[model samples]
Target: MGTLEGRLKGKVALITGAARGQGAAAARRFAAEGAKVMIADVNDAEGKALAGELGDPAAYAHLDVAEEDDWAQAVDRTVAEFGTLNVLVNNAGVLHFSPLGQTTLADYERVIRINQVGAFLGMRSVVEPMSTAGGGSIVNVSSVEGLAGMPFLVAYTASKFAIRGMTKVAALELGERGIRVNSLHPGMIDTQMVSDAAGGAEVDFSRVARRLALQRVGRPEEIADVALFLASDESSYCTGGEFVADGGATATHALKL
Candidate 1:
């Protein structure tokens, strides 16, 4: 695509959890597509390194998404560097896998605080700036687990579901202000988080592929592409909606006779 045709050109975006995984992938893609992005994460070393690699000022921040104060500072920093903020990608999250009985309160709180509350604070912090800028987009990174309950991962699943709900509510409340809010649901993907959650458990990747119509685990870029769509003017009319990029995992029938 021509540079002007780059859907995100001239947009200033802030993405949390950007040190690695899906967040980092989205940061790279956003920069490539012509958006000046603020890569926010608690991992200062990695975050700053990524910013250096992006080779731009205003490209990194030490943002702990679960902390409301950190969110405020990140927003301010982005505006101070980029001149304006047009997109907020609530991508920072934590995953703790355990059965309901085994899940600890501490783990649950950490997951929900980062995954759900972080998104909440991110929208709250950026909405005013976005409205003043004439409009903006907020993309919350949800999960397929939000759509269906899994055997393990009670805390992780809970947080994702909460995000999905909050995304819809925020969308409705922010739409009149010209700000759009939406959630992106990703299914099983090849990432360090997933591998860590798997924890050496014997699982068949091919089996997972066969379960989904696409017959494959998704890539970070696959989900990032959806975020890009929701963050840009291309999806100008979309808001308060759930974008399921789960490779048809949710569409399959439960009963396979």
Candidate 2:
């Protein structure tokens, strides 16, 4: 449905957290665009089911982004199955909400380990294989939280900020190798992550929308549209920069106004 649809014809991709949410949406979109996709996630049942639904035997792997060995093996398996690796979407992440005072070391550690370290490992693990396969693109799913602070999500915010910082450095370091690395700063989209962060709090979607220049929370597919562009050659000249797909959430000081 996007302009970049099918631009990745015959390319292969390995997407983490591909069982659901943004990851699942990206996987389906990538495959629809003619990329042989491997949906990797810790959720065995859902991951396997998604693979079946994609109807590609070699298109899924049980991956826990937190584990180094698992990350390496997933890339290996993907190469074995698909014969190449052209894209890596580091989409596996968890959102934990808590005020600074309520945030424990364990909670903070878990958040960073999954959200930040996971992407690092994914990039590191894929470098050699991707290099051998003649370079590739790495798309990291960061958050608008990385651009600004949100109350009660100290750990999540910190982790995403770290991802934003790391992504730039990774892009610079990998560019010479013919690989392009970019991070996506997604605005609050409709997904379970937002639901959990909202946590039954009294809120107004209308007010939230009015604050945005676009005046609305975006859909998962809307974010996927940007992902598709980044994944395909349409964005060939882009790297080491963030694509903010937020619905004008960061466009102005509307919240303060």
Backbone atom clashes (below 3 Å) for every candidate: 0, 0
lDDT of 1 by residue, 1-257 (tens): 32446779889999999988899989988888889999999989988999999887347889988888898899999999999999999998877778899888888898888888888999999988999899999999999888888877888888899899998899889999999999999998777776666685655688788788887989998888889899989899999899998898888667843
Over the stretch 206-231, how does candidate 2's per-residue lDDT look in tens digits?
A: 76787788878888788777888888
Q: Compute each candidate's TM-score over C-alphas.
A: 0.94, 0.93
> After superposition, which runs of candidate 2 have C-alpha atoms over 4 Å from their true positions?
3-5, 197-204
Colliding pairs, model 2: none
Error of 2 at 165 (Å): 1.4
Q: Stretches of candidate 1 above 4 Å error?
A: 1-4, 199-204
Judged by whole-model lDDT over C-alpha atoms, candidate 2 comes out at: 0.86
